[model samples]
Target: MFHISYTVEGTWRLLKRQGWSWQQPARRAIERDDSAVEVWKKETWPRVRAVRRSATPGSSLRMKPDSR
Candidate 1:
């Protein structure tokens, strides 16, 4: 180490002077499949969203049965 002290403000100023700026990371993973996403949106998501509560008569939200 050269024993150089740098503050956050000073480092940002130096970066800006060198034509660099902070940027947000990409929202999606690099391994994301665009075609798969499109297929899911077209073929699966609508059917999933259209399913009504009455269609699932056997399903329950309760984690445990109520005590009598």
Candidate 2:
């Protein structure tokens, strides 16, 4: 028989800031024969404490310069 569990943290954008970051947490469970076992998992992403808005007044931050 075998069992495992784990936890992970970080933001999608900040994690991707360095490179192409597309991460998903690893799944864990127990393996056994004729055994009764229970499993549970929870995923939580903390809200962005400091969500950024436009860089300047009356300007769009996500807009590209070449598009204007």
Candidate 3:
């Protein structure tokens, strides 16, 4: 019983790390929180990829701004 519980908890933690959204619309969890999580994602996600690219060395090529 203990081993089963431990395994289940470990799997859930791993899934959480993999971006499993408990606040998914189908889960009804986001509604109770007044959709704060969803709204935050809307405001935050836009720059995530850009920020990552800026942080990576040689991730982008420097070209003349007007280069076709």
lDDT of 3 at 56: 50
Tell me the tens digit of each residue's lDDT in model 3 across 1-68: 46544587788898899988466455664437657768767886785746443455452546645646
Per-candidate RMSD vs. true structure?
A: 13.3, 16.2, 12.2
**Residues forming the 10-long window of minimal summed lDDT in candidate 1:** 51-60
lDDT of 1 by residue, 1-68 (tens): 89999999999999999999899876988999999999999999998896555654564565776679
Model 1 lDDT at residue 49: 93
Candidate that would win on TM-score: 1
Cα-based lDDT at residue 46, candidate 1: 93
lDDT of 1 at 23: 93
Please list all clashing residue pairs in model 1, or write none if there are none. none
Can you tell me which runs of candidate 1 are displaced by over 4 Å? 31-68
Report the alpha-carbon TM-score of model 1 versus the true structure: 0.40
Q: Rank the candidates by lDDT, best first.
A: 1, 3, 2
Model 3: ten consecutive residues of lowest lDDT:
51-60
Could you tell me how far off, in angstroms, the CA of residue 41 lies in candidate 2 after the best superposition?
A: 10
Candidate with the larger lDDT of 1 and 2 = 1
